[model samples]
Target: MSRATATATGFIAVLLWALLALFTVGSSPTPPLLLNTLCFGIGGIVGLIWAWATGSVPQMRTVPLRVYAFGALGLFAYHLLYFSALRLAPAAEAGLIAYLWPLLIVVFSGLLPSETLKAGHVIGAILGFSGAALIISGGGAGLSTEYLPGYLLALLAAFTWAGYSVLSRLVGSAPTASVAVFCIATSLLSFPLHLMFEETVFPTTALGWASIAGLGLGPVGFAFYVWDIGCKHGDIQLLGTSSYAAPLLSTLVLILAGIAAPSMTLLWATLLITGGAGVAARASFSSN
Candidate 1:
């Protein structure tokens, strides 16, 4: 794909991801483990079918086991921590904290053999982190010792995803097939987790089922494939910086869904995060 097409695909994938927070908003009758199992199982099947139809099925067996393992573990850990954190803390705060992955990506990208660390990247990361902090505080949930575990889990989720993205860059494989492997691995792994720790509670409402379907078909499934393509073929620095917009877009999704209200604090958060990302992107280009 051309750079422009890859970039557009990346943005579209990010937009799909923005809907994730909304889809996972309310407490569900379904347990997190079971929900993950079902959602990703469906996604895996879909991806497998797509791979088959596109003549990519043969490539699935070609992916390195290490790549499969890392992709699966990373996604599973992220969602596990994220879902648990949502239950333990307020969604807004948890979401903002988890969204720190983008900044972490910029920071960690410097460790790559082909990438260089830069002062502007560090400064931008600081600004972005500050903005995320502001959003968390703006939620008006004062420092309660009660939610400390949740906070830590969300931070870990951010770290885990950042590591996953960085590591994925090193994998030379068919992107769609890799995503299929990821989904299938996550689905299989979640089964034992659900049986061990959770009681299965299937969705009983239309909205609940819809959320599951949306998640399976969009964010959890195709988005991963698109993201892989973008990471491999697109403008890495620009995509890294633009990803800061995901949380802001997620917040807007929540507001539109009536799960959250508009606040001036969010406006300020947007400005800071966007400015920081822009600064980082400029620095990356100059360094290159």
Candidate 2:
């Protein structure tokens, strides 16, 4: 694909991810563990089928075991923490906090060989963290002691995803195959946890089923493959900077879904986060 097409694809993937909070809203009849199990299980099956159709199945075995191990653990941890946090705190707050992965990516990317940390990146990181702080202080139903654990989980989700993204760049496997492996591994790991700690509760309504399907097909599934392509072939700086839009879009989605409402704090947080991303993007391009 052309750079423009690849970049657009990347943005579309992120936008689809924004809908995750919307789909998962309200008290789930399904436990988080089982929800993840079903979602990733379905997604993994789809991914495997896709990989087979695209003749990427053979490539799966060619990948290093270390890559598979990291991908599985990272993906598993990210979703586990993210879904758990959503149950504990308001989705908007948890999402914004979890969205810190982009900023973390910017920082961690600097650690790669031949990459340099620039002043704009530093400034952008500061601004981004400031926005995150603002959100934590005022974003959701208000930060309280009750939500502390959720907040920490969201932060850990961010960290896990950042590390995953960075490590993905080092892996030489076909992205689709790798993602399929990750999904299957996560599902397998979730099985024991689900059996041990949570009862299976299937979706009771059509809307709930639809939400599960959407999560499996889009955000947790095909989007990962598209993102891998984007990162490999798209305008890296643009993708990096525009990633901040994911949280903003996700917040808007929640508002429209009646899961959240617009507020001054969210507006201010948007400005800070978007501005920070822009600064970092500019610096990244200039450095290149």
Candidate 3:
């Protein structure tokens, strides 16, 4: 890709993911019971559109019980934690805090024989955690004791996501596009979970549906599509740095729209979290 094209695509990535997060903030409290499921429900439809746009899409297998099971499990837990966090805390809080998963994965990576932490990785992890602490504190004791549970829940989101990211690597040999199949499988699974857990399966409005579609398509659907392309064609360094830009963008959009009030404090946290992720990615990149 030309420099111009890469730059343009990068902008799209920044905008799409950030915008999706803002939507999550705005739509969560008012939305359908299974907010996350609704998002992915919309996402599955968008995934198909993207597939058709590219060319003929691959048909997913119905016999792969293991793949479907894993898919379902990942989506189910991620949504549960994600929506719960949104309800429990501010949108900016939940979004920025969730980025901590990069550091969590790095710390855990040291346990695996395949990954070894370097001096820089350790330093980055510490800095990242400290940065998050600062943001939570925010100038003069912005940390409400009430906010603790939401923070912990966001951390759980990070942990669940980190585990999923690592588990995903084990299956990296599969076709990149096949992840879409996994997502559809996730949707199939999510409906049942929503049925059991939510006690209802309904959204409030077209806007809520739109929000769900945005998540389904962008974060879960189109985001993956772009990511598959990125892995094939993007610079690892660019991907590392740019991945962190999402939360900042999301927070900014929310604040501007009067849905969330954020600060440059988010920038500090973004640095630590994204920096840690970059370190981990580089560490993994070097081992290969």
Say which candidate scores most in lDDT.
2
How much is 244 displaced in model 2, in angstroms?
Answer: 2.3
**TM-score for each candidate, following the candidate numbering:** 0.89, 0.91, 0.80
Deviation in angstroms for 278 in model 1?
Answer: 3.4
Local accuracy of candidate 3 as per-residue lDDT tens digits, 149-201? 77777778878977876686554334445566667666676666667766663
lDDT-wise, the better of 2 and 3 is 2
Clashing pairs in 1: none
Error at 154, model 2, angstroms = 0.9
lDDT of model 3 at residue 142? 80
Candidate 1 matches the true fold with a TM-score of 0.89
Model 1 stretches astray by more than 4 angstroms: 1-3, 135-141, 171-174, 233-238
Model 2 lDDT on a 0 to 1 scale: 0.80
Candidate 3's TM-score reads 0.80
As for model 3, its CA RMSD to the true structure in angstroms is: 3.6
Highest-scoring model, TM-score? 2
State the C-alpha lDDT per candidate. Answer: 0.77, 0.80, 0.65
Model 2 steric clash pairs? none
Report how far residue 87 has shifted in candidate 2, in Å: 0.8
- Backbone clashes in candidate 2 total 0
